[model samples]
Target: MYWPNCGKGYLGPGGLDNYGKYFNCTGGVAGYIDRAVFGNHMYKHPPCQKLYENKVYYDPEGILGTLTSILMVYLGVQAGRILNTYVNVRDKVIRWTTWGVVTGLLGGALCTFSRDNGPIPLNKQLWSLSFVLVTSGMAFVVQAFLFMIVDILRKWGGRPFFYPGMNPIILYVGHEIMRDTFPFAWKPTTETHATYLFMNLWGTFLWVAFSIFLYKRNLFLTI
Candidate 1:
């Protein structure tokens, strides 16, 4: 793959693997953002709470995000156990999650498209969940494609690793671009909900497309 200087310039199959390894091992994506924005660049980026403020509801924007934050923490402990094979979770809920996601995406999109030029509400309790599931699914798709990339590269004996430095840097760079470029220019400043909504959707589709492309080429990241 031809390399570009900026993260945005990264393209083709191996790029995702190039980043996944670094971010996967470090504080995941969030920590990488901290280092990229704080350690390497000027002006620390806004807090996640600030950047992803849920406007429609008072949840995270008020005491809700805090509440969910606690639950997320709890889930982390449980997740560790599950990944280590300490316990196997039943697929009952997650099995139905895809349907929920499709509904949410369709509903959210419909509502979004119907609205005129204005700021959308955050509704973290409702919408943020959509963001999480959608992105998580997208990430998995990306990983799958990266896996294929690695498989083919091995035929020629070129080994590549998904580094531990890529996730946050990519997110930070993407967020910064959104904040600076205003890709969704029609979105008003007060419409934080709409901003996040569209950006995430864009990210989701972009990553999914990337994954599909890589998968077709048999280029995947080797974890």
Candidate 2:
């Protein structure tokens, strides 16, 4: 007797490993975003509120997510290559800016195309190729913008952002661990979305402030 809902066997043959099952069953990134943005009815599992499994959604294991990450890394490598190879500062700035604009436009086009007529939609959970293009392109544009502001203008305006970038591991870990703790989080006056949204913004500001403090003290954690 072939039981369709049998244990691990039910994971099927689409690279649906244990982690993927967790994402699919528990309503991983895709589920949460869909629920919040599109008002989709998300199947919430008690104790673990962020995940929901629905076989109909597919790509539960996030294979594409990993692949898109590699593409992002490649973009970083290309940036490094551009910096190292370019002799003239003007050339470097122009090249990086041009690449940023091109990629950003391409990403936007791809996203639009995918939305209307596509092999796959731009899904954050699936890490679809369209999603990769959009994010990586935006990343390129942001990098170019910073390059122009800090490197070209020789301005100290980017210092705050730089502080967090310098010690990202520390900032990330600290934020995750302390996000729900006192000061970072507190009882809201009202149980409304606005209240929670303000709390989130407050948490972000606190981290930036903490990063500034660390920067002033010359306390940097480098791996």
Please provide, for model 1 over 106-131, each residue's C-alpha lDDT reduced to its tens digit, 9 standing for 90 to 100: 43453353322112222332233333
Error at 98, model 2, angstroms: 3.0
How does candidate 1 fare on TM-score? 0.30
- Candidate 2 matches the true fold with a TM-score of 0.63
- Model 2: per-residue Cα lDDT over 121-173, one tens digit each: 46555565666777777766677678777878876577667778877888899
User: Could you tell me how far off, in angstroms, the CA of residue 191 lies in candidate 1 after the best superposition?
Assistant: 7.7
Could you list the CA RMSD of all candidates, in the order they appear? Answer: 17.8, 9.4
User: Using Cα atoms with residue i matched to residue i, what is each candidate's TM-score against the true structure?
Assistant: 0.30, 0.63
